[model samples]
Structure formats: C-alpha cells, structure tokens
Target: MHQETRLLIGQISDTHIRPKGQRYHGVADSNRMLAQAIAHLQGLDRRPDLVLLTGDLVDKGHPDEYAMARELLAELAIPCLVVPGNHDHRDAFRAAFADHAWLPAAGPLHFCVDTHPVRIVALDSTVPGAHHGAIDEAGLDWLHTTLAADRAKPTLVVLHHPPFASGIPYMDGYALRAPERLAQVIGAFDNVERVLCGHVHRLMLRRWAGTVVCSCPSTTTEIALRLQPDARPASFMAPPACMLHLWSAADGMVSHLSTIGDFEGPFDFA
Candidate 1:
C-alpha cells in the first residue's frame, strides 16, 4: 500500500449508548446523534474500507445497551471493530460483538494486531468500576513480545485511554495509571508509527513516547477542548465527527476529520 492507496478507515469513539436509548452524559438525541454520524460516514466520496468503534460502546455493561449498539453498528457496510472501555462490561461487549474473539484467556481486554504494512496493536485497557487506566504486566509482556517480532513493521498502538495527560483536569485523573511501564514498552519499540485512542471525547493530536498520538471526537457528544478546567462539563455540538485514517506501505500515515454536516470553511485567509 502506498500513500496514494485507498485503504481508508473510519473511526468512531465514546458513543456511551444508554439502556433506554437515552442520551449519553446528558447529551440529547442520542440515537439521532449516532444516526447522524453513520449518515456522515456513508456520504463520504470514498467510503472507508473498515470502521473502528474505538471503545465506550455503551454507558453501562447491560445487555440491552449492547444490543442497541450492536444494531447501530451493523448498519454500516464495513466491519466495525470494538474494544472494551471502563464503562463497558467485558462480557457484554464480547457478547454483543461476539464474532470478534476478544482474547485467549477470559479477560476484559481486546488486543488485535493488524499485520499489514502497518501493524495495529489494539489493547483492552478497561478496569471495572475504575476510571483510571493501566495495561497489566501480562498485557505489557504481550505488547513487548509482539513488538519484538517485527523490527521494521510500522505499528499503530490503539487503546481506550490516553497514555499521557491531555491537560483536561477532570479527565487527567483518569489518565493511564502506571503509564511509565507502558512508555518503557513503547520506548523499546522503534517500529511504532502512531497510537490512536478515544476516551477524552474530544479531538486531540500530540506526541507521546516519540510517537504521534491522537483521540477522535465522539460520534454523539464531545468534551470541550478546554485548555484549563471548567466548572461545567462541555457537551454537544453540531457536526458530530469521526476520523479517516489513511495508512500506506510507502507514505506512512495521513488523516482527515470527517464531519456529519456541510462545510464552508475554505474562507479567505485575510
């Protein structure tokens, strides 16, 4: 695959679907909001080859919520890959997206390694009843062993939480606990091209452990891009967004942020 290649992927995250088809985090019109996102993806000129539901597939680990989310994702023509989030119950997520084998042993994590030109290692970093994050020693070892096998492969490490701070005070507390260990593993691997995650409920791009890392905004709601903490949590905005990641064997990676509505922003740079 070259940079000009058309292997595009769509990314949706932090949906937080409610059991009664209720709004998530108090964001109104949850189903409509999600539907809007799907419509957006469908309208893309070059439809994505695949779609990744990067975590927070539901609000609670309830069966009904999973059912709702499952049906929602099934509407997409492409494969929708999922992993568990802190709010997601592993069993429910697996039961919902049952076709994708979660892990070798019974665990809440989903670690999928894409072995194409770019290797994507998806790790399940959810901890039940806990907001903070960490990949256990076993997960770390798995990452290490996987990375060790391929020295020249370009890799993308996808997970639920940001391994570092996004500077949002409230969300910062939930930052990956014991991130240094994870950093060490990342440090050891030179083949890592980037890392993608989706817990902040906002769009962000920054560097971590010498790799490009970013979070795609929610398909339903978004956390405000606050440089400083705000008393009231920021919520819904128009043009619910997802990301289009273009990875290639020759050109590395390029990205585009996809929106649900029209745009007029090629304005004069006056």
Candidate 2:
C-alpha cells in the first residue's frame, strides 16, 4: 500500500448520543462508547484521512442530545461527515453542524465532497416523523445530477437507511422505501464503489445498484440478529465496532470491521 496513494476512511455509526449523564435506552453508555470509538480511531497505526458518521446521532430528536453529540465529536481531530437518521431532527441537526460549509442552508441534508481520492455523496433519507426511510423524487433527481457530474471518480453513496431488507422482520419494517428508485440512478454510475449506511445497528452487506452496500455497526448496542418472522425486538451490549475503508488507485476499496475496546493482541509469533 503506497502511503501517498491510499486513503483510509473511518466510519462510526448509530452513536445515539444522549444528554450528558444519560445513557441510550438507559442501558448503553453511548457517550462513553463514542469517546472510546474516537480514541480508537486516533490510536490507529495509520490515522484515517477523515471520518464518516452514518446516522442515529441521537436517541431522540432533541437539541440537548445534539449538544451532547457535538461535545463528544469535538474530540475527533479529523474532519467528520454526517447524514441524518430517523431519530434526528433536521432543523436541530443542521443547527448543530452549521459550521460545515458543505451542508446546505435549507432543504434535505444531502451534499457531496470531492476533495478526497474517492468522491462522497451523502443522502438524507429520514422521514420527518416516521421511522421508515424514503427518498422523494426531488432527492433522487438531485442524486442523479450529482452522480452525473463526475463519472470517472470512485464514489461512495451514503444514507441513513439500508436500501435492502435485512430479513429481520421488525427492522425491515423501517427499511428504505421504494429502494429501486435510488437503485436505478446508482446502477447507471459505474464509478460508485460502495453505498454506506448505519440505521441497522448491525454490520450488513449486500450487492445492490452495481456496487456493495455496507451498514456500519453501532457504537452503543447491536440490534438482536433474529431473522425469524416472529422474533421480538431487542438489543444487547454487543462489542461496539466501526468500519475502516481503505482506497487506493490500484486496489480500489477494501473495508474492514474494527472492534472498539481494550483487547489483548499483538503477540509475538515465534
């Protein structure tokens, strides 16, 4: 891996940050776990060029929650890109990240970043008062234009909802609505390398839109992976994790799941 040609992007999702001193669902120490995730990123042998935070930034759409999220994110030394999830309030989220020039002043929080080796197109799929996600016609049109603008660069299309169902009936109930609409646009662009998402709270991958769609694991808890139709809704204190995406001109992109916490490792093999 040539250092100059390769770019490492750290992805941490579904942080679900709450007000200071409060835990997510009164079980997971979301704030502390996010801190640990940030520390883990900073301590990596090779630091990421930037970090992408897929959504569910807060448990509730509260200003105080966003405040707590901002405070925790401030610890990150590199630039962070964000998208809104079902739990986020658009107005409050925009206000919290007003400093980011890439964020639009109005409308859905969709934007594109082309400064890095790979292009990033972040879509806002949150429905104001609903847990299910959808991309209206206007959003799809915008995506078409954005993707058309640069067809040669390797791109990443990011959104809060995974476009495909996870087979977990309860979670699938809120999956992206009319995914084929988005797929049609994405399928046309051969430069797109991956579609990144986070609402699932579990790492998932699927082949869609001529590319790979990967959902990041949460920093707080893992939604129980029950695939049965009658399974109950639940979450557990599974080891929190994040994704590391490495891209280079020669290798394209490779993703790795990194667990966040203290674990014994680096033993000498003689």
Candidate 3:
C-alpha cells in the first residue's frame, strides 16, 4: 500500500520516570532509557505519525517527576498522546500537559482524537490512590458515545491497565477491575481495532472485547512472569522495547515489538 494510506503509531509505555538525577527505586535509570526510546523512534526508517504513551509516565505522582518526564518527552518530534496510570495523579498530570489541546480541562484524562486515518479514544482507567484500574459509570457512558459517534473509522482504545487477567499472579492482582464492563462498551463496536495498555511491564496479547488487546512492554524494567499463585513480585533490567502499529485502508493493523537497544548488524539474506 502507498505510504500515504498507512498510519504508523509508536507506543512506549510504563516509563516510570523519576526526578532528574534520581533513579527508579534508586536502581534503574528510567529517565535515560526513555531518552534512548525517543532516539530509537526518531531514527526509525519510517517515522510514526504519532506516539501513544500508555501510562506510568513517572515513578511517583509528584509535580517534579512530571516536569522531568516533560523534559525528556520534549525530545520526541512526533505528536504524542498520553493517559494517566496508577502511578499518576490526575491533577498533576493535567497540569503537566496543560498545553496539549486534546487534554480536557478537568476530570479523567479521557479524550478522542480524529486527526489521523484511525481514531484514538484514550480512556483514564486509573483509580485515585490505588494500584488497580477501573472506569466509572460516566467514563463508560462517554466511551460508548464516543465510539458510537465514529463507527466506520478504525479506532484504537488506549488505557493504562490491561483489561484481562495476565495469569501472572502479582500483576493480575492489580489488573483492571471489572474488565467485562469496559469490554461491554468496546465489544459493541466492530471498528475498534485494539485496546492498548501498559501496567504489566511485559508484552502481552489477547483477544477480547471483539478486538485484540495488546500490552506494550515497559521502557525500563520487565515484570517477572511467574504463573504460580504464590509468585513474588520482582522486576528485571531486561531489554527495553516499544510497539509500532501500522494501519492502512487496504490492510488492517499489524503490530511489531521493536527492542530499544544497539544490536548487531542487519545483514542481507543474500
């Protein structure tokens, strides 16, 4: 398909950026890794039409952390959209990205963007002062209305937490509460392409809500995947990565996981 008919979206999630000069949990350098992810996106052969940050943008819900995140994200030349995560404070997040026109003045950081070939409906699943996620009645109503408004356009629904049980005990403990409720609204729309998420800190995919639910890996650490019910919570300094979703009128969306690091040569098959 022609390039003009395609829309490429770069997705980076769970950055968990901390204040300048500080490390996440006094260990992982989330800030530096985020910078590298931005560089990787910038250096891509086909630059993304836009970028979606699935949340946990900062380690803490502090204003200074948001400031640091803003500084690092400023390096990205592509337009970016964000949704609040468990680690984010709604008010602080709003104040940080106040300049973005798509952000609402108050309430959950929910909004829809129609400027591209595919429509974007970003939902705030973060529940204040909690690690789990949920969408209130109002948010659900808003989502139904928004999706119903543009049923023909391919759409992406962005949220912070995965809407399905990850099978990893620790992570599933804090997964989106009542996913079926959200699914009910999403399953009603056939044009809804994908439900993108972050919180699990690992890449995961499932078919739900009449669409694919893909969770992007964190740019800093990977949540240990232990299916045992008694599995402990742990993270590793694994290879960071990002997701590139390419959509076209003729072909549907195809996602690729791009590892964020300097690797060996890209040799030819011949």
As for candidate 1, its clashing pairs are: none
Candidate 3 per-residue lDDT, tens place, 1-270, comes to 645589999999999999999999988999999999999999999999899999999989999999999999889999999988999999999999999999999899999999999999999999999999999999999999999998899999999999999999999989899988998999999999899999999999999989999999999999998999999999999999999999988889999999999898888875
Output the better candidate (1/3) by lDDT: 3
Once fitted onto the true fold, the runs of candidate 3 whose alpha carbons sit more than 4 angstroms away are 1-4
Clashes of 3: 0
Q: Mark the 10 consecutive residues where model 1 has the least summed lDDT.
A: 108-117
TM-score of decoy 2 = 0.98
CA lDDT of every candidate: 0.77, 0.95, 0.95
- TM-score (all chains, Cα) for each model: 0.89, 0.98, 0.98
Q: Which has the higher TM-score value, candidate number 1 or candidate number 2?
A: 2
**How would you encode candidate 2's per-residue C-alpha lDDT over 1-270 as one tens digit per residue?**
645588899999999998999989899999999999999999999999999999999989899999999998899999999999999999999999999999999999999999999999999999999999999999999999999999999999999999999999999999999999999999999999999999989999999989999999999999999999999999989999999999999989999999998888778885
lDDT of 1: 0.77
Lowest lDDT 10-mer window, candidate 3?
1-10
Clashes of 1: 0
